[model samples]
Target chain A: MISPSQVEVDRDKGNFHYDTDYSFDAGIGLSEDVIRYISEVKEEDPWVLDFRLKALKTFEKKPMPTHWATEDLKNINFDVIRYYLAKGQKPSRTWDEVPDDVKNTFERLGIPEQERKFLAGVEAQFDSEAAYSRMNEELEKEGVIFVGSTEGLKEHPEIFRKWFGKVIPTSDNKFSALNSAVFSGGSFIYIPPGVKLAQPLQAYFRINAENFGQFERTLIIADEGSEVMYMEGCTAPKFETSTLHSAVVELVALKGAKIQYVTVQNWSNNVFNLVTKRALAEEEAEVRWIDCNIGSRLTMKYPGVILRGRKARGEVVSIALANDGQHQDTGAKMVHAADETSSNVVSKSISIGEGRSSYRGLVQMPGHLKGCKNNTECDALLINNNSQTDTYPAITVQGDANSVQHEASVSKVSAEQIFYMQQRGLGEAEAMSLCVNGFVNDLIREFPMEYSVELKRLIDLEMEGSVG
Target chain B: MNSLKIENLQASIEDKAILHGLSLEIPKGEVHAIMGPNGSGKSTLAKVLSGHPSYKVDGGSATLDEENILGLEPDEISRLGLFLAFQYPMEVPGVTIANFIRAARNARLPEGEKVKAVDFYKELYEHMDDLGMDRKFTARSLNDGFSGGEKKRCEILQMSMLSPKYCILDETDSGLDIDALRVVSEGVNRMRNPDRGILVITHYQRLLEYIVPDYVHVMSEGKIVRTGGKELALELEERGYDWIKQEAVA
Candidate 1:
């Protein structure tokens, strides 16, 4: 088995190959012609083509965000972005069948090894398409439908048509509309009723093509009495010019079912990672979102949950690390729409150097709901004097019997704490890292074993040279 | 050479004076105990000697074997061979005890040198065993979720690993029961050596019974009011602080 520490070292080195051979025309922006061209290139069905066209119209009608915390959206220059770039490769079923360059990329990222050791299945996506996808025989025999979204649309139209865009409609936001219009190369998982997958299904997304936007649409449906854990890992080669990764993910947990989704997003510093992910929990169903955001130039993601059935539960455990020139504006949103529902949201962020990390969350208990409860706690640690952090949590409790609580705190690595560690012989930087690691250790423990180790190493790497 | 000395120490918190004109010296190969009542500035003296930022030394000085330590940072003071086992050890959430001590040991090494993982773990396990700490505690966060006794043992475990020339255990026996106090004292006793000096701070004489000190000093209102042999602790425990207060007033 590959040690998680080694993965951490490799992630810090970030020596992934940037495939310069692939190039696409960037002047082509979002348009009906572009949508039709994408459909033609994918050989998509006529109905899928019509859906893309309708989404393109919605994308055009929606206005840019006027109430976001930052103003970088005004400079997006959508016309300069290449909405879809296939990189001239079709999805392969076997690792050996994949091109050497693409396979080597996944190998360096430790995806193939992870698949063999612990993952029940694996899907590796490069740029705009899944270059390789596979499932273990045991899972395949059990009738689990795990494939790339595009393939799912083609093979299982019945399941695809019924739930696609239902959780997050095209008009949800400007970025969601854009993703719906040009989405490609994400996972589609359907766990059969009453069947629990023993191991997590994993996917790795990489952006090796420059000036390209990766809009992968992922949808997971856990049927009644079923349980499954899905993990998504993403990275991109460092590019001088900014790349955009705007994807939308939707999850549905049927009555008495449970779904746990884990995401470890470590993009290069030159990418803007703006994603919208949400889930719908039915009667007595449970949904959990465990997200770790470690790297990006600017990231704004809030994984949300809507409790639609009585006695359903929703939870979100998130950790964000923002270092030099990065802004991680992330949190979770929970809406209690049914009676006797409960939700918990715990968010921890660490800001180093001049980085800024903010938590913006919402919890609403409508008047129709009775005996609902929601609790949110957002804590931030600033490593240095120049770093900054903020928390903005909004909780609206309308029902008389509902309860809501919100707590937030921001603290710096105390000089005395560093001195205490240093007196034991640690240098200033090592002491600061230890204190910061201890500050977020509780949240890190919530992650899978491998991810928790990798997250610590990532923090250590970002902490190097952080103190004078 | 392994001795700690404080000369006419004057310190304050937030510019308000606390420890004023206090002088004490502890020599190597001996254990000294400081007994005091509430608000006697016992904790502040420990913090100032370790260079806690909350306290500013407006005047006076302290030294660990000829090295002026008042100007150095708390960590620097520790690295210079003094260790303050905090009365209330901060609960460091994500850092395991092994890693925390390892970082401390690594800091002591010259730049570019690294500690071998195998040797580090071996040493940690041995010290943990000596302190009667479970091997699993090495993997747990430092002092996080630890009982009062377990926290004190953790401090002793750290003191053992660092092997400081002068160890100042601030209120080491606070909140400990009879069994826990004995276990913690045994851990400290195991580390007793001719090359080390220990200063144990406590309110009750029960701790001194197990980790008996060579000398005992009664501190009242930031100054050492009286100094005597080990029997001083026994006398105070029997008669209480009123006798010490009467002596100080006289």
Candidate 2:
């Protein structure tokens, strides 16, 4: 077995932090000054700075959430968070050329090795900056553009500006407003027309600084007749003082194109992971969101899809595991805006110890969108008596020809099942792990093979100390 | 010395009586078939012996090799040489058959002892082959998306791998077709040993044709009404359970 220290070093370097200052004294509130400071730091064009300023105003005007899953929003202090922190380094094109500390972090996280072995491209982000970004030469030659969002802005402004914040606008939600105001260091991917990338492009995000908010914005566009898969892995160090990670991601699948976005968020219990992700599917296009949330103090994420064209399809497969002092509130939203649109949302969550998990989803079809169909299934597993899980799914079908089905169930690991496993010679913990694994195995299998293995290992790690 | 003895065993579910004054014994090297109609406490007996928490044993004692098994936890009972193949095997979604069985096998070893993966898979494949299970089933979740026959075969496969001292199979043939029944029975037959006792519980005697129990006990209203050799199963099958109910009343 690989030593935990080795695995820690390999997995921790890029994203996991150690012993950092916890003072939230940086009173960089959501203001014009902070937005200007960020734009100045990035040395953005005048028009980009104007965009940031407008977004900052939007952030200030938006009120804290007053709707569903808003109880935890009270703890977020917008004034105390450092909007942006740059280590003063340009993004490197090669892993070896990256700075030592950042390179060591990615090395520890095994980012470079994973990129070499499995990924067609990799972008390593440290705090508020992209330390290293690379694309397979063949992919670049094939007109596939994968780069950090900042670089994409500078290099391919036309493509970047067209889809940026389009799917999820700044005023869409309070978190999206915050992300648009001070977003930094996320991937911008564009698959050219009719180009198909077999291998996934991955991005690794690491939160090393303390009392800071890492807000990154990502936009991916799969043009006509193209297909691509993008995977993201994120983690943060355990800290007593709360750290914030807010991100906004937007995806566009043009006619006859397909795109799948996969995210595995494994933040420490001290980090607050609040993200907004959505995609738009055009005629005959398909979009899929494969998301897994394993660790966090409080996480609120719902990846959604808007079916904007006839015959469009969308799907979201997600698994959320909350252990101890954690709360994972996640689900998906599907809006059928055109005729014959179809969507499926399957989400499973496991709550152990005193942790709580909730599934909140929505399926909406307008009266004019005939032949639209949606299916939503949400299941939760409680590992212990103290754990809690809840599911709230809302479906509205205004069209007579539309069909929607929703099913949800919450159950505990029965003592009989545990005893049966033990009788087969499994210990209590092993049996519980098997049950939890079985509970979410269907969704995990939907991930890429390598990611599926990592997910199982992560689940096993969380299963530790789950049973007493 | 060779039996799983239940001396006046009494059990209940939700404070209601289920198995009352039930006493039976199956000795090693023998297969005892317990036949009963629905709600006759046949399934309850299997669960109670395996320490299902829903059932509370209020009185009497059950012993494996003279060790008081009543006070022990279910897992402890299982580890102490008893195995219960559930009639409705729970679908453990993400857990593969190979890993599930391995974890069970690992539990039997001393602390810090590990099972060699290669050897474990080799053994698993061999057992799966004997059960006529496709090797792909090892990669699939335990009983998830499986047919009734597949689930029963999986239970038998687990039994074969765990190799318990005494095995209690609950309604193992309830949902199987003729072909699946034969395959599952063959898996159980191969696991029979001189040192291992088997208790088969079924509503019908059709399973006995393949498993060939050494003894057959007709249970009515939570107690063993009559005990006979293998011929009793054939007789029960020929006359049906209504006759047994009439005899119990008489």
Candidate 3:
């Protein structure tokens, strides 16, 4: 009998890190001078420079958090991380105009290809040009502004000046302070009132340097009666030395508007990813965060929403996977500030080998708010005896007229389920992959169709050799 | 040439014997039914044939045609054209029925070959239609939250799609209603051909009424003690298995 031919493996994940010579490098380490050098290099305004120095002070003054924290955070040597590095080139509008180094990434990825492919680089180029041209023209006429944060600050200060750092301030968290001190390259978007974009704006970011830090600050504001979805992807090349990725993303959904932010981050096992993401929703506005995490040595990300206006709603659906010496600590936070607000958070995690995953969450509704509701669901799937998972949720419901429902479940791959699939002709590995895929299927389905397919393939690749 | 031959099969679960010196032969082109009461090892035999990890085959020689499948993995056995319509089909959440069955079908293809999507979906839709399952069910998770009759019908839908050379329906009628039984029986009957053999395991003659057997065997205490034609099932239904046990002693 002929054995099945080897299906083409995901070479991208394996060779994801080959250090290309950088045109410019800041070397290694962080200092006040390093922060000043970065702001000066970016040619920032005095207000922004002052903002950076203040955030740097906060970063230096705040002690590393130990509460529900991983020791990996303490392992981060502030002195050894390069605060910033850029190739000294600007983003080109057309594929032909892009420099050779950056062009290599998106030569075939197409000009109007959703921004995620350019930033994420998780897979090889796959979108057709005809499909891009058909949609790019329609988006241009809708008063939707999608650009880099640098360009947004330089060109459209009217939109960026007020909303930047408003949702997540520099001192909100230690990592947010660090990011505020040296942030670069994240997307900046503005949607005018009553305008809606059909296609999601996408951006991709990856780090190739070891012992380096990538700090990206993304700000998106959807005006009243407007709707937009922004998605970004993050993947870094693997290295022996530790790398740090700290990002701060702030979003504002104005009255009667909706904004959905989706992130699929798969960093190398040696990277420490600490990110602060939060959204402020106005009256009758809505915001949603769909997060998928697959690989990292340690990741502490809790995408949160502040329901600040009446009848506002917030939702977060996330799935995290941890494998062999990896830790993924992620969850959601919803702070209800107005009456008649609603929030929902659904989180799923899978731990294989000695990998450990945790869900740390907070849901709060003050005593004065009348008729607010929140629902939280956390599910964990362990693939082996050595795998571990934990869930810590802090929910405070003060006074009356607030309802909260929380459900948490931890499960192993069912032996009966494995045997059942086997009886139908799937091998042990195939059976395991199917079960793992099934475990996160409901949440993964929430992703855009193109991404859901690649995400499943990536999950299948991780499940290989997962059988013990 | 299709024959499921088991000789002096001795199997156990956790060192405790279940099947003691059981022997059964099912040849091609006929439906053979095995009827027994609870704890008679009917399900054990099915599990052992499928090479379930829990069961230890102490002494057994089982073969599908020329190959000895006594110790092969369940997937290997399935690829070799042996299908078991489980008594309690598993619930696989988030795995669509279309993908599950497609994966199974794809397992049979040679290296690097893929099952054509059009042909696969056409065949799936045709069989699902014949089984009276909604087209939407194909996209739904496999047997997840399905009613008992729905589960039994799904088993038959799989059986019809896979079209194995030798099929052992392990209590396929246990949870099925009369309408479901008739539909499941018809789906099974549609696959009856000269090159295929079917072994139906049941506790009562109710299912046999819809899917008639050419030969009937009464298994008592883990071994087949009596063999007869179609009339034997009716007689056992009327007289009960106790008489058969007493008759065996006499």
What value does the lDDT take at residue B63 in candidate 1? 84
Interface RMSD of 3: 4.0
Candidate 1 lDDT tens digits, A285-360:
9999999998888899999999999999999999998887889999999989899999999999988777899999
Provide TM-scores for the models. 0.81, 0.82, 0.89
Enumerate the candidates' DockQ scores in order. Answer: 0.37, 0.40, 0.51
Interface RMSD of 2: 5.4
True contacts kept of 3: 0.82
For candidate 3, write residues A129-226 as lDDT tens digits.
00111125455577677777777788899889998898998889899998988887677788899987776777666575577888878898999999
Write model 2 residue lDDT over B1-250, tens digit each, in one string: 9789998888888888988798888888989999988899999999888877668998999999778898676778888999998899987767788888888887888899989999999999999889899999888887779999999999999998888899999999988999999999988999888999999999888899999999999998888989999999889888888988898789
In order, the Cα lDDT scores of the candidates are 0.85, 0.86, 0.82
> Which CAPRI category fits model 3?
medium
Q: What is the DockQ score, from 0 to 1, of model 1?
A: 0.37
Docking class of 2: acceptable
Query: What TM-score would chain A of each candidate receive against the reference chain A?
Result: 0.95, 0.94, 0.91
Poorly placed runs, candidate 1 (over 4 Å): A1-11, A23-28, B1-27, B31-80, B87-91, B94-157, B169-191, B199-250
The CAPRI-style docking tier of model 1 reads acceptable
